[model samples]
Target: MPGCFINYRTGDGEHVATLIDRELKQRFGSGEVFRASRSIDAGQDYVRALDAAVRRCEVLVAIIGPAWLDSPHRSGGDGRALDDPDDWTRREIATALSLGTPVIPILFDGAARLRPADLPEDMRGLARCQNRRLHHRSAESDLADIIEAVEVAAPRLGDMGEDESSEGDSGQSSGGGVANTMRDVSGGTVAQSREFHGVNGISGRTGDMVFGNSGPVNTGTGPQYNGSTVHNGTGDQIGVQRVHGSRNGGESR
Candidate 1:
């Protein structure tokens, strides 16, 4: 069962739903996050699967994009798809709300906050839910905020690593510890240490090693061979001896 269910319209917030699913899956395990396109298996009843997921999930994220409120219904004869009861997006959110599941409204791609007048009677309560904003330029930070909110809403979903958990708890800006390091440096030079060791040789005809800005560049010492070798390392040469053996004990020459 999923702890988080992503509810989104096909044409309005599908991309944002995918992004949220991926990020949540990474923080929580993949099994803990649900999205229709990826979570529903082939030949399965999609309606049943969606309803079950919504009922079981601890949180339902409703990704509302610019077109979400005014998108046309699939039936091609509607004022807006959200007003239609058969619409999956509307149904999923309605189910979550009815089941007392925490519903999170995510505003994306210049979407404005929801207004009660814009939604049907059943969905008007969604306008009262606090909303989060996500923009292309600040996606990382926005995602961090959403994750923190989810963690708070569902403490049972608290399996993130220590570093990430701390980041979420502190309400720190994105980039994790790297952002903290940059913030702490006032005027003096800040440096980070890193050492790369290879058990075997690191050699190639044409290869490049890249490092981030925080650390000094240092490549390990090793011997270079024209062709790929079993091991490439700096060491004393040991004597090589040849042994004569016979296959199946047939003969030796």
Candidate 2:
């Protein structure tokens, strides 16, 4: 399996990091993932270690939260408390874009809520990639989605040889297959969530289905449903807003 570089907000960074690490360990015997918490050494070397980890990875999964934008690194304010471009998560996003790596923008909080000016220009370039949503308080389902995305983005040789459940040697299974352990702030888990496969272009949960592809295939079919698929109190589609992932429970989409 290829190493993964996770780009997420500090606030929710630990939660997302934990989920990714668990899945990686399950699949590759705990040696594959370069998680910041466990991989980083003490002192000044830690910063360099993180940068090295980012460079070594093939796929960059950015766990986007509402605070993604307005980063201090981009603003040049706060008396330059953090180093230039250091605090800027956008810089990492830009690096991924520049490297032409497969960038998966996992929508935690709604990305649509951001105005164009509020976001890093590179993130706005996401006008075309596949965007996934992890509903409020739904960590387990989100964890499953993360594993699925990893399978799509970074699969190892052993993974090809065995079944999906075998992908996780951790003894955790998603029913008959591998399982993802996720819990919200309240520690409650969510059932299966909807996900799109092989489709290019944008697929977000903001308001209505907003997507378009310039390629031969048109994946602009609109929102996909899983469960009840009923309208909310206002009679609007229920799964519109982009709820973020957290140790605390997420909103039911």
Candidate 3:
């Protein structure tokens, strides 16, 4: 069963839905999140699939964009999609609302807060529920809040997410922990990090470096090779060199 069910209209907020799905899956692991586009298998009855997912999910995330309520119906002319009971988005949300499932409204693209007066009678409750917003400028922080909220609603997701985060935890046996492998670092100076998981080992000659323990930094005169490893994840190796009293350039030779 999916821990979270993502309900989104195809044209309105599907992109954000996909982004949320990817992030949740990355943090929680596979099969824990249900997004119709990615979770529904070919040759399966999508209606039943949707019903089952909604029923099993701990919470339903409704992605509401600006066009959500006014989007044209899929079947024919210019009728509003939300006005149609058979609409996929409408059906999914209505079912979740009727079933008393936890529904989280995530409005993006400057969407206005839902108005109960504008909603279908059965789904009017959705308007009264507190909502969250997602903006491109603050997507990262917004998603963090969203994940935290979902984790609260579904304890199973919390376990899955934490396990994934601590997969390669690094650092000393005591104190803050590190990861086994760090994500690619673009550009910056890192000195004396206490709890950073190091993976793959330093390719070149490593000076004053410890994989899991704290190490020293280069405090030499003129220019010194601090031996700070930059893992870009590409096959090619890029060296980082520190030159004192001059412009910062060139990797250590």
Instruction: Estimate the TM-score of every prediction.
Output: 0.66, 0.52, 0.67
RMSD in order of candidates: 12.4, 22.3, 11.9
Q: What is the lDDT of residue 40 in candidate 2?
A: 67
Q: What tens-digit string does per-residue lDDT give for candidate 2 at 146-186?
A: 76776677655236425645644643434333233322212
- Cα deviation at 94, candidate 3, in Å, is 1.1
Off by over 4 Å in 2: 71-84, 109-117, 157-253
**Alpha-carbon runs more than 4 Å astray in model 3:** 162-253
**Candidate 1 wrong stretches, greater than 4 Å:** 159-253
Residue-level lDDT for 115 in candidate 2: 47
Cα lDDT of model 1 by residue, 9-110, tens digit: 888888889999999988887899999999999999998998888989998899999889999978798588887888888888888888888889999989
Clashes of 1: 0
Clashing pairs in 1: none
TM-score order of candidates, top first: 3, 1, 2
Summed over model 2, clashes come to 15
Least accurate 10 contiguous residues by lDDT in model 3: 244-253
